[model samples]
Target: MRSVALDLGVHEISFCEVAGGAVVLRRTVRSLDSLEDLLGPSSSPARVAIEACREAWAVHDTLRNWGHDVLVVDTTRARQLGIGQHGRKNDRLDAEALAHAVERGGIPLAHVLSPHRRAIRHQLAVRRALVETRAQYVTTVRGILRACGHKLARCTTEGFLTVLSAAALPAETRQLVGPLVTALEMLTPQIALADAALEQLCTHEPVIVRLTTAPGVGLVIAAAFVSVVDEAKRFHHAHQLASYLGLVPSEDTSGGRNKQRLGAITKQGNAYLRVLLTQAAHTILRHKSGDDPLRQWANAIDERRGRHVAVVALARRLSGVLWAMWRDGTVYDAQSAAVASAKGLRLQAQSIEQQAQSMKEASVKARRRQRSIDKGLGATRATARSRPVSTSRRASMH
Candidate 1:
């Protein structure tokens, strides 16, 4: 069997062809195009291997189209298995290593998204960038306003840009900040356009449709979750899915015991997905509608610990729920949600009852104090009335 390996060197592409576990041909190729001239058409089919990189997928697709088996491996694993272990690092060695890795099945083939999926991801990415940019600009306006010594009143109707433009301020402050208002005005439409594009994209994806069916998950989050997770079955279990999304707790294990360190999320997966999930979880907890097990768990945690921990835990659970739905092809069930939410609601009601009891106790105490004061005042009045005319001067009265 013959195998070809490509090393995307810094300046040039290195090509190595091996047969029977020996290098039969080695050459430097300028581009993927140069492969045809370097290695002429062969009678026997050849397997091609490449290190996973930005260009790796393109090469893999092209070579596969040309009737050759192509394997794309993790660059890190390739380095370790081929060059790192051997203490040799060079394009030639890398190419040889990739070939060996492919032959030995040490390199698991990389997955490539379909063209349609690729287009969808690109659209999602663009929308994400626009949203981030708008947030940054909004933050800048808020900071600028804060610096001008104009503290916004609570519950003000004005947004950052609106306040900046409308708030009465010194001429210098207006001059420095007025242009920002205009910029925000211009940027608002761009953000709207991005949102519209995202909405349209979401409409085309079935997974997003199903995900949006869940309470607390909006179109942006559903779409992002769908995009980041192209396959549901990749995860062995729902917990694995949650862990992959970084919604799980961090573990500190020692002395044969596992303890949750209670820190920030492990954040071991896609950060954007994690953020979306957590935000969705937060929204779910805040919304008074529909029941969710994750929300119940979160609220319980919140009461015992805090809302912060509850929200994070809820986000992790949300990830698990998504995985369950995707893996089982099941829709959200009101019965299940009800069962889950009952625990949280009961806890909430119990908390309210406890608070009411405490309030009642305080009221009783307050009433008793008022009664004591009133009684003392009445006694003093009676004593004054009983006394002979006290209005006279003390020395004259005696």
Candidate 2:
């Protein structure tokens, strides 16, 4: 089959078609609607490729419906296809290069989302934007108040406007932030409605509900996971799921001894879902009212490597756990996990005790050494005083 590449621009769409490693045709169109003019829909289905972006998947579905196999190339790897080189880049070059790359094959493809799941993802994105905008407005108003020796008491975002109204404030102060207060009041109800929609979605999607059975996996977290993943079977294992979510340490190894260079997570995936997972991790860590094997495991890491690293590690593990639960069609089993981790917990306890004992012993040794030095100094002073009178005999004679 032949290959085709599309570069969707703000005002123009550039496309290239290639067959047998030779260019068949290339053109620039004014809009996506103009695409049908260059190629016949009933012709043999070509392998179409497009870089992953906001419009990429929609175009993918459109092309697929028209009888072509579409590949949404992973944006992170688009450079590998020579989309941009030197200092020059344009729609025509990008489309041509992508077309040739598609013809040659082996380009990495982005994860494809079903239309239903895609709609869910878009809804979640909109909700996130709304929440963030509200937060920005709240922060600005709070900053203004703080500058004037006033502080707002803690309250739910929904109750923030009510709280502000009840707090004693000068007329000028109230007048100054009136617009932001209005915005917050407007946002709160919309956020509530968005939340209700998610709850309705959760009711219909059994997989999302199943995911929520894991601790710290709330409606939002579960929904985000389900929408982003689309299907559980796509990942063969929990580790792959975590990696796909970019919760794993990134590695770069090369040359001489091939030493692995491990670094922070490659945030090459959906950042929204990743941040949600991290926030969920923080919630689990802070919930001292409940204890479980997962919490115990995270505490052990916290003791060894501080709280920050442990939180990230827990987030990664939590992602994996969620994936496993979804894959196996089982809820989190606290008893089984606690039993499995009992041995490690015991070892950690012993290790912590040993470290404390070692520190105590070292402190005692340091005190003893200081005492010995003090005694030596006293003796030296006493001997020097006893010898001082004999040493001054010549001075007395003079």
Candidate 3:
């Protein structure tokens, strides 16, 4: 089969065509629109290779739509295939090397997220930016208050303003901190809008709902997992999912007896998703960690190792749970015995009400608090005004 490689760039793309282990054609096109001259519609379909980057998706889709098989090759390993060899690289060299790699075969490929998943990931990124920016403003207020000898109680981000109101900060201090507080008030509604948008997306996605059945796995984390993994079936099994998410431990070994070294996790994949998974693990192990066999197993690891090690191990395990849940279309079963779970999803599907009522029965606590504070999350809406409304502030409200 003919092999073609494209070096995608912001303003231009270098194209190379390799046939019979030699470069037969080369061209530098300023735009994908110019491809008709080089790869006309009547030309035979060729396998195309492109380095993984932001533009790779558009390139992949464009080539596939044009009747070409596209491979979004991994950028790091492609360097080994003579790209940028001995400190020399350019668009033409890169494109030729990619064409040669494609012709040679067995080049590592990157997963190209479907358009739907890509859209969701982009939306989630917007939401994360809004949330993290709000958090920074909130943190600034905390530092300023602390310097002023006013310590606020630990409260949810959404209730930070409420907590501030209860603190009754001095008039001069309020004036000094007024700008960020106003910013927070402005951001709260926008963040809420972002959340509402994501929630609306979740309504159509049954996988998000199903994944959250795992303990401590909430709506946002589930959405992130779905967006990143995109399709669970692409992965052969749970361990592949864990490895894809970079949960597996790093290893170094030799052929000799007992010559092996295992270190920290490779941490090769999405950092955000891994952080959420660890957070979920900590939440699970925080209370009644021995509540089930899996939790107990994590707890045992905790007893043998440290909290940090145990948390990561549990996160790794949780990845398997998520994959199993998605692959098997099953919810988590806290009731499954150790023996039963050894083979497959230790979980049997149950009704929504049944799970909820049973969970409440298991852990009954007082209801003094009417709300919850999520990590880096703030209030959905502004409540009582922190200071007397000024004419300028009232006008700015519009």
lDDT of each: 0.66, 0.75, 0.78
Residue pairs in collision within model 1: none
- Roughly what TM-score does model 3 have, to 2 decimal places? 0.82
Sort by TM-score, top down from the best: 3, 2, 1
Tens digit of per-residue lDDT, candidate 3, span 216-305: 677788889998898878987667778878888888886675867888899988999999999988988886455676678788989999
Q: Write the per-residue lDDT of candidate 2 for residues 8-111, one digit (tens) a residue.
A: 88788898998877888988888776777554576677888888888887888788878888889998878888889776799998998899999888998888
Q: Candidate 1, overall lDDT?
A: 0.66
lDDT at position 39, candidate 1: 39
lDDT of 2: 0.75
How many times do residue backbones clash in model 3?
3
Clashing pairs in 3: 157-378, 158-378, 158-379
Q: Which candidate number maximizes lDDT?
A: 3
- Per-prediction TM-score, please? 0.71, 0.81, 0.82
Show where candidate 2 strays beyond 4 Å: 85-88, 288-290, 339-398
For residue 262, model 1's alpha carbon misses the true position, in angstroms, by 9.4
Per-residue lDDT of 178-198 in model 1, one digit per residue for the tens? 676656555555555555555
Query: What ordering of candidates by lDDT runs from best to worst?
Result: 3, 2, 1
